[model samples]
Structure formats: C-alpha cells, structure tokens
Target: MLPRGPRAFSQAAATALRPPSGSAPERLCVAELPGSELAYFAEGGGGGDGGRPPRGFLPPPGRCFSFCVPSGPSAGERVRAARLHRRAEQRLSREPFGPGGAAEVLPLLAYAGPSGSRPEKGFLVRDRRRLPETERALEDLVRLILPPPARLLSVYEAAAAEDGGGGPLWRSLWRLQGAPESKVLLGRARVAGAAEPALHPAAPHLLDGAAVFASFEAARASLRECLSVIPEAKAVLDLVDGCPVHAKKGDFPVIVIEGLDATGKTTVTHALKDSLNAVLLRSPPPCVSQWRKVFDDEPTLIRRAFYALTNYIVASEIAEQSTKSPVIVDRFWHSTAAYAIATEISGKIQHLPPVHHPVYRWPGDLLKPDLVLLLTVSPEERIRRLQGRGIEKTREEAELEANNIFRQKVEESYLRMENPACQPVDASPSREEVLKTVHHLIKKQCHFP
Candidate 1:
C-alpha cells in the first residue's frame, strides 16, 4: 500500500522525485531513494487507527508512486532480485507506455539495499489514468517474469493522488499477488508503526549460484528442459551431443585466454599457437558458430547454458588435440561465468558476489585448464582496437564498450575464480611484446621446455 500520514509529505521531496518535462519522447525515469529516506517519508505520513500510514499525503496525480519490498521479510531470505529487476525492466520497456502513452525504456534508478548493497527492486511509475492498461501490463509482465524460483511477491497498483484530509493521497488500489512474503513484511511494518518496507540484506551480492546455477550438471539438466521453450537450444545442443562428455585429459597442458573484446585475445592466442605449436580451440567452438546468433537472442538462462555446454564439447576436442600438442583455448569457463555473472548482476562491481564466494569456484566436474591467462587493456585502448577491427561486436562486447560497471564486474569475476584463477596479462603493450610476455609466462608456469 502507498504510504500516507497526517503530517503531510514534503512537497519538496515529491517535486524532486518528479520527472523533468522534456521535448523528447516519453521514457522511463529512474528515481533513487534510500530505504531509510523512504521509511522516513512513510513515517511522516502516519495516520489512521491501525497505525498504517495516514491517507492524503501524496503529491498530485501522475506523480504518485510507492516502492515495495521484494518477497521475504527476513534479511537472510534469498531471491533472484537482480534478475527479476532486469526481466521486469526488459518487459516494461517493450511496452508502448511511459509518462505518456508511448514510451521508451530508460535506465533504472539506483536503489541500494541496506548499507549500500545491490539494488533490491526496480520501480516503474505509470499514469493513473491508464490503471486498467497498467493492470493488464502487470499481469502479462508477471507471467513472463515469474518463471519459478524467482521470489517477487507482488506488483502494487497506486491510485491517482486524491485530495482529502490534509493533502493529496496515494492509495494502493490493489496488488497482483505472486507471493505471500511481501504481505508478511508489510504486516510486520504496519504493526510496528514503521514507515519503511523491509529492507533486503546486503549479503548474497551479485552472483547467487542457487539463483542461477547450483552446479554444472544441474545447469545442463535445466538447459535440456528449456530446449522445448527455446528452439535454438536444440541446434546448440546437437553440437553438444556430438562430443564425448567424459574424455581423459591428454598429456599436454591446456591454456585458456580470457578478456573483454578487442583485448588482443585473438592476436595473442594465434601467436601462441604458432610459437608453442599448440592446438587452438574456443568455446561455442567452430561447430556452433553458425547458431551463436540464434541462441544469443535467447533468455539469460538458455544463453548461458548454451555457452556452458559448448565448453564440454571443447573439452572433448581439447582432450583429443592435446595428445599431439599443447592446447590454447581462446576462451573457456572463465569467459562463460565472467560474462554471465557480470550481465546477471547489475550496478557497481561491489554489487558482485563477494570475493571467494562459491559462485566464483570452478565447476568440480568440468575439465580444468592447466593455466588461464586474462588479457587486459585500458578501456580507451580496447575501444581503439575495437574500432580498428571493424568487425561486428558480440552482445556482451558491445555492452562492454558502453558500460563501465559491467566491464569491471566481468574483469573482477575473472580475477575471483578459485582453483584455476586467471593470471592477469597486460595487453596494452604492442602485440609482439604481449606475445613474448605470454610465452615467458606459459613456459614458466606450464614447465614447457
């Protein structure tokens, strides 16, 4: 329910939250509010016998909205909050509605959890006149957004600010209930005469394995189930099925090269292949390259599974090739998990799962590399190289160019992996220097003569 109180909510705060009038098309506007500040605002509006927020304190129509808590009251309760926010934002942006009837998706407001943690929710404010439309949209959005294991409880609808009592009031017309945890939190808050909704805890960070993959085997099984839903999965899976899943590692060392796009991975790996006389391979290996675009468009779960399964196929190839020569992989599990984790967790790098978190661990069953080298270049140099290539960028590569937070998260995720953690290699230097440096590391680390 929208918070209300007799003290009259601050007009200044409302004005500050309002979207600026612009000549451009209607777009989603992100509004940031600390849980503490929101609670203070809600408490200031206190009224009614039940000690619920008092009515008639909201600003005028089109400007009234409330932020709700994620499902689960306790801080320890875990939910796919980041993914849920992302999925909801994606759905809402697709719809033709915003401040006006026609709208575009805008960047989400930064709402940090307690003590500046990952954002708990993404808030969208719609015109009250389109309540019916908003309700229908919410229903459809929820249908697509709630795919099980996601714990979003409800999407509350706020009435147009109504004039009564002392000031305008924002009322909760209704909530499309998806889970009961939200109600429990609200009930407790109301009972305690607290204004703030239950603030989510700071732990769980960005990469919660349970929220995505508990294990490699579990991810593969889930991918199979999603095959019916995402037809692209079959084409990608066919490539996976052709390879031997259980292959013995050959005598030679298997080295993986990891980095963001235009980070000299191709140049370095190719050079290493010639210098070391090693067999070259890559995930989403040459076999599935044709279908890469098809699965890239799929949902996060399906897309990640696609890439992950490819590694196993690559693993089989590595086993075979390593018998004759050293194996140099363009990208492998580190690339897969780094990109997936970075994309899944929104906001700053700090929002990423804590260092040494289980999500950063190497899969116990997957084939392990002898040594992994992560090539990094300054952002400016990376963009310069990207321009120099003139090749089409992968989805993540494109995002890497534009989103610093995302790029940082991917870099950090690469650094955080345990067991076979990646060794950093500065690729900012000349291509020849970079290769020479890598050659030294490989011979030193892999005991190559």
Candidate 2:
C-alpha cells in the first residue's frame, strides 16, 4: 500500500529507492496519506513500521532515514520492496556535506577533466614526429655561429636540456661539443648578448681565443640537452672561417742588456755575444738610424715614441736572424720602460701609455730572450767609470750626475725587476772578475757549458 501527501518527501523517496537488478513485483500496492505524497510500505516483514523512521535513525545510532515502496501480495513483491528500502537506508547513513567536502571532491573533478596548460612558455613540446625537424633546426643554428666539425654541439645540447635549472643560455651556446676554436667564436657571440651589466662590460675584454674556446666548450656541455629542444637553433651553428692564432718562428737567444747610464752594459753585452757565438743586436735598429740620434739628443715623449717604434723594427730583424743564430740585444723593451719610468719620476714629462710601456707587449707574442745580464755598479763606481771613459757629457748625463737621489731610485727600480731570467753581475769587480762571473753564471743558468 502507498501513503502520500507531500511531493518533496515522495521525490526524495523515489530518487533513493531501487530494486535488485532482475526482480519484478506481482502487484503494486498504493496508498494516499494526509498532508504529504504517497509513501508505500510492505505489509509483510518486521519492516511494517514504515510510518516511523528506521532503527538506524534512532538517537545515538547516527541518524538515518528510510523510504518504502510496498510490493503486491506476492513473494517477489515483498522481496522488491525490501531491496528498495535497504538502498534508501544506506544513502541516509552517509555523513552530510561539510567544510572539507569541496577539497576532497576537487581531485576527483580534476581527474574527470583534461589536464591544464603550463603557466610559462619556451618549453619544448616534444612529440616523436617533431624531433627530427627540431634537431635539424638546432644543428643548422649551431653551424651558423660555429665553424665546421661542431665538437661542442653535443655538450651544448646537453646543457640546454638539463633539468634542475642546470643549463644557462650562455653555457649552451659556448660549451657545446665542437672544435675549440669554433666554440670560442660562439662563446664571444653569446657573451656579447648577455643582459647582465658585469657580463656585458667584461665580455669584450675577456674574449681571448683561449678563453673563448674554453668557455664555449663548458657552456656547450652544460646546455647540450637544452640545445636539442630549440628547433630554430640553426642560426647559431654556421660561421665562416675567420682569423685564428698562429705560431711563427723567431730569433732565439736574444739577450737584451739594460741598466742606468754608465753601467758598462754596452761593453759587457758586446763581449758576451762574441764569447757565446751569438749575434749582437741593438734596439732602434739601423732602419730607424735617424730616430736613434733623436732619442740620444732629445729624450722627450716624442723621442720616446721613436725609440719605442724602433724596437719593433729591431724585433723584425731579430726574427729574421733567429732562424740562423741566437741574437744578443744591447738594449730592448726593458730599457725603454726603465727610461720612460725614470723620466716620469723626474717630473720632467708625462708617462707613456701602458700599451707603449715595453712591459705591455703581448705576452704571447713578444720575443723572449734566452738570457739577460744586468750589470750592477755603485753610484761611485758608475761615476768613476764615466770619468775613466772620457765620454763627452750630454745634458741628460749632466742631470743624472747632478741628482744622486734620483739616480738611486733608477738603480733601485732596475734591481726590483723580478724577471727570473735577469742575472746581476757586479760591475765594481775587476774586468776579468766580471767576465769570469758572467761566463760562469751563463754556463750554469743557460746550460751552455
């Protein structure tokens, strides 16, 4: 029988009720209740108390609700009603929606939908079909910026694709697997493009061939994996052959003798060259013969330039002679620097630019002497030697003789040169003693004996 009055109660009951999959009732019993919609209860079974809620709904039992739909007076009808009521009881037993309900359900909702997009860009969306095209693009880019036989490309790609924030763009471009020279070229380009002020300011100064090559190789290896993902990377790959560092043979054993005036350096160097079977050379090569006279007469900044330029010419001559024999230089770059520094100390003139400073010559390119002998003489001994020589006085010589304090500073500077190859011979010794010391020191230091 069905009892009914309220539509809301009937709808709730209808939605909650269900029958076991393959069951059917013999006859349906209907009832009409007051003030509510139809509510049916089977007459059979202990569940006849459908007018009241289920025992599971009683206080302290966790409140529950139940609905019943009476079946016809047949065994199947009774079974169907019992099953529907059981399902309703189960539904009402569950806890009602609460604060954490939304959180608990959110994951389930997300699982039912498509995954969301990434927030940032510039990522490789790798699919097997696109890999070949992407790789080809990257290869082409690498060739554009780097020369043939890309030795560092693999390294670059690896660094570029590294996870854990391991790869930086500079590393990828420069340190890729490629020829060292090519890597250097690429590294320069990348460094030039850096946004940081320090990197930008330092790039040009730091981009030497050796440094470039090293950085490029490092960056490539570091960014290698990332490079593989950049599909348009071909722009950085191709580059034309450009200038490269090359080695040239030059005169060996160019021994340059340098010291303050009246040190007997010229006489000692000439004698040493003769004894060693070495070619005696002088700075301000004969090619700049007139400039040599100017330097001796004027000692001004202009004259200094002439003297400096002459050293290069002498270097050229020595380079040519080096193939045939070792060259001994009476005075070379150091003499130029010493005189320039001395002049500046005297407050007589402004100093030369660092590039003009003989010490400022390219460390890799300058002519390295096999040995240098610095003749040291006390001021008294040096002045005495000048008197003994009967040499005519020049204005510079007169000034030097007058200023003993200034002269001491010059001597001190020479002594502090710190060049390992310089050997100091005491000029106060007897001529024979000096020669013996020179010969012995040379044989020991140069392994000529």
Candidate 3:
C-alpha cells in the first residue's frame, strides 16, 4: 500500500468503503446507517419472495471508489456517487435494449491488492448481443482490470446504498485483480454472469476519465494531485511553465489535419504547411515528447492525461505560431477526443452519444482550430499504406486494421464534434488529388488564400 488517502488526494488513492443504499437482508450481513463499517450480504430479493441468493453470498469486502472519495468519505462521496449513478442510469436507460430488454448483462470486476495505493479498475455491465467479438473485448477488460487466475465471484441481488435510498437501482457483484500490462479494449467485457447491474458512469471514461479532460488547468491540477508516482515530476512541472494558462486564439488561420497513422496525415500536413506558408505542428508537441512513452506504460487514465496535457503545450505553441502565419497541425484535439470517445463506446456509431450530447461537443476551454480536415482512406488502401511503412505499428494502428468497427467508430466520433467540426476528405485518390481536396476545403472552410 502506498499509505494513501484520508481525503481526495492521497499518496496513492485509499478507497472509501461503504455498504449499499439498502438495509441488510434476512440471514444477511448488515451494518448501521452510512454503512461505512461493513457491507451486508443477503439471501433475499427486494421482493418479499424469500428466495435465497442464486448462490451463496460471500461477504467480500465492499467495493470502494477511490475516485469518489479518498479514504473515509465525506458527504461529497454520496453526492458524487449519486451524480455518477444518475448519469449512468440515464445513459443506460437511453442505451439500446438496456433495461427491460432480455439483454443479458455481465458484471465487470476490478481489484488492486495494496500495491500502488489506488485501485485502478472499472466496473461495467455489457450486453451479450455481439457475442464473440464483444466477448473478447470483455475478456480484454478483465485482463485489463484483473488478469488471469484472478477469478471473479458472481454475486447477485447484492444491495446498494442507493437501493436503500432512491439512487439508480442495480444488483450485482464481481471480484477483480490488477494487471499492469493490461490494456482494456474500452467497451464491454464478458464476465460469466447474467446479473446485469447498471453501468458505472465512468465506464465510458474508463478508469481515469482521461477523455473527460478538456481543460489544461483541470488536467494539470489532477495530475499533480493524483499522479505522485509519475517518473519525472519536476520536469513535468517545469515544462508546464511554458504552456498558456488557457488556450489562446491568434490572428492566423489554424487548420488541423486528423487521420489514422499512414492515412497521409503527415504528408497532407506538410503539404498544407508549404502551400499555405503555415507553421506545422503535431500534438504531444515535441516539447512534451519526453513524457509520452512514460505515461503510455501506465494505466489508461495516466496515459491519456499525458496526451491531454501535451495538447495544452501544443495549444500554447499554436497561440504563438498562429500570430506569425497560418498553423497546420498533423493531429490535434480531433485525434485525441475521437480516439478516446470511440474507444469508450461499444458496438457501432448508434451506440455513441447523439450529435447534441455534451460528450460530442468541443471542450469550452481548449483552443479551436479554424478548420479541421479529416482524411479518409479505404480499409484496403490503409492496410497497404501500413505495409509500405516497414515500421512497427502502434497498438491502435493494428486495431484499426483488425477491427473495422473500431475504425468506423473513430471516424464517426470525429464527425460528431461541434464548435469547429472536422470536415472529411477522401484520401483514396492520388496524393495530388488528396492535396487538392484539402486545399479546396481550407479555402472554403477557412478562406485560406
């Protein structure tokens, strides 16, 4: 244990454990109100059926949310948990075939044994419609939060504090173990149980809610507070000094080109830089490049935080460079949010938040590009381009090639962003054609001469 938490920011994160919202059941373990002492296990349904638990209810330790509260929770924990539960229920209720449907739900488990302090795990309830692929993704989530040989117990009708109160109702339990090398595939993981509890709100954020970070200031404060274990704290701080307090606007046109790797992003960005006499930039700006791989090795939240922070650094640069000439970026928030949101949602575009949803909107704080050009290439061509690289592919790139659904989800996410939305261009044509198309879009969208 990292000797963490009596409050929100601990050496690591010490979990604030509590019982469910409801009272204990017959022959069940129970504790008094605020149930911080212990969580009770019962053998009865909320209905007075007196039906025993589907199986024996093992009195496992109550699942504590370190993010919700540091150690022992204050009133803040209940409020936060309630807020999250509301969001989750709303999202789930809107979800296709969610509640009332015969859709089978699988419980997700997360566990960390006093290792690094915080328990980095996510819990979710996934439907069984997609079968094998979804099944594999669920397995990946399990391996992500709790790797193999760390079996999870499937408990049912487990009471929740909300059920006791009027929180979103759900009844399920699962055991989990942490795996450092684990890379959860974002969406649904198949735990072998039929009890589909409501999804955790942060499920979409997935562990650290890195995708939720839109403002640099918020991200930095959180990073400093929660990420004491980061390898180069002083270096990170010094680097932060160079970034603008907030994303600033400049006089010149700012165009961001976004696409998967080998989708001619670099080529198009370079061309735009030359053609428009613009400054070319890439995210995780070279200034913060030193920290990319470090955070990449950590969990999803930390890794995403690094990228999120890097965007701020780039924003500062953009503020400066745009004053000199038009700025063309190889990738920007489009890439970050698109990939993050795409990874968060399961199945297809339909499952994603609707166009008007806040999740699809641009961060109010970040600098917006004058125009964002999204390059699209056919799957076959993209694969061919990847082969030509003769370079090692990133995990995401490999996933792009292997999972078409993932690719579509990413593209859809890009299209859904508001407040300076990304415009699509077909990169399937010849390089000259692609360049011409981009130039045309810039002139039309940004009035670039």
User: Which one is best on lDDT?
Assistant: 1
How well is each residue in 184-267 modelled by candidate 1, as lDDT tens digits? Answer: 222211111123223223235333322335345655664666555557667666666777756667889999999888888889
Residue 313 displacement in candidate 2 (angstroms): 1.5
- Provide the TM-score for each candidate, comma-separated: 0.68, 0.39, 0.60
Better of 1 and 3 by TM-score: 1
Per residue, candidate 2 scores C-alpha lDDT tens digits across 248-331 of 335355567777667877778778777878788887565445434433543232234344444555665677776776677887
Residue-pair clashes per prediction, in order, are: 7, 65, 11
**Residue 396 local lDDT, model 1:** 80
> Model 3, 22-42: lDDT tens per residue?
534322222111211112223
Cα RMSD of all models vs. native, in order, equals 9.8, 37.7, 14.6
What 10-residue stretch in candidate 1 is worst by lDDT?
A: 184-193
